[model samples]
Target: MSMAQRERQQLVEAMTAAGPEAPTLCGAWTVRDLAAHLVVRERRPDASPGIMLKPFAGYLDGVQTKTARKPFPELLEEVRTGPPWWSPLRPVDAIVNLTEMFVHHEDIRRGTPGWEPRELPAADENALWSFARRMGRRAYRRSPVTVVLATPDGKRAVVHSKPSGEVILTGKPSELLLHAFGRDEVRLETTGDPESVRAVLSLDRSV
Candidate 1:
């Protein structure tokens, strides 16, 4: 299997083992919801399953098969087959799909005990951070926050406004990433009126 495929397998295994009560990064979803989310791909020929999944269409225009009693191997096979039957989605459609698959998989693992997915290469982690950062541009402008990250691990992330200087925010990259992604700690971490950090978070935390 390719590295991506291997990673995909790990993702499936993690979700399957997650059972019902496991916590996912998406506070709204349980591990089971995440498994279901992973299994059901979309039928968008133009867009990949990740794109469809990202908007959380899984709950919106979603369908669940009566596979409750089915073996996990069978359930995973259904996901492997792709979902022209459910909706239109392109497989490996874009970076968004890969990133979603990567991040949410981590969410599932983060929620569960003894289910840690691989630590992810620093390069890979940085890449995802970079992607999110790039996508974060326009949204950050509207908010009044600037964020900078400093870490004991020597990893840092700096997100700030360019001209307006409304909000200034910074912290560890991972912390910043987590905060950007709807972490409760982030909300409690409001530093100043430059609530723009939270504003940026509110706007872009969807993924």
Candidate 2:
């Protein structure tokens, strides 16, 4: 299988083993919900509907919104069908997907309250960095700040947000990416402020 496929495969293996009680990032979604979300979302965008957009009480969620999950077997069918939109075949989308995986893994890891952080694939990690470096400078992310990523393993990247100000952030690049991707509860040292980092991450998910 290709690197991207392998990465997704690894994610499936790790998450499938998580018990129903295991927490996923989407606020109260068990690991099962997370798997289902990934699987259902990977299908044509048309698969979901207005029910996804309806308002509700506690835990109201969009169909393919960030934290939904599905059965492990269902995700396997998506694999047999094809890759999700955010995948290597789409290059940029691949990075986007990696960011999702990394962040969501934290969701599961933290929700469980005592599990270890699952190590992401090196290539996926690198792809996310490359994409972040580029996307950070787009008209959308334009800010006068320098975002530095220092991963636990020492992977590093320096991205400057121009025209805003010189802001600096440093941490395990993956950790930063996860925090930036809205997994929540990720702690990182900041030269500017986490609010700024939080803004960037929010945009990454929303836009």
Best by lDDT: 2
- TM-score per prediction, in order, is 0.59, 0.59
Native-referenced Cα lDDT, model 2: 0.54
lDDT of 2 by residue, 73-131 (tens): 66545644445556433445343455555555556666766555556567656666665
Residue 120 Cα positional deviation in candidate 2, in Å, after optimal superposition = 5.4
What would the per-residue lDDT of candidate 1 be over residues 1-207, giving only the tens digit for each residue? 433454566677776677665678776776665555555444333323443456644443344333223465666665555444445334543443555555565676666545433555675556556654554453344454554443435554455545443443454344455555544343123344545545655655444
Candidate 1 stretches greater than 4 Å from native: 1-6, 43-72, 80-94, 112-118, 138-142, 148-178, 184-204
User: Residue 10, candidate 2: how far off, in angstroms?
Assistant: 2.3
RMSD to native for every prediction?
5.7, 6.2
lDDT of each: 0.51, 0.54
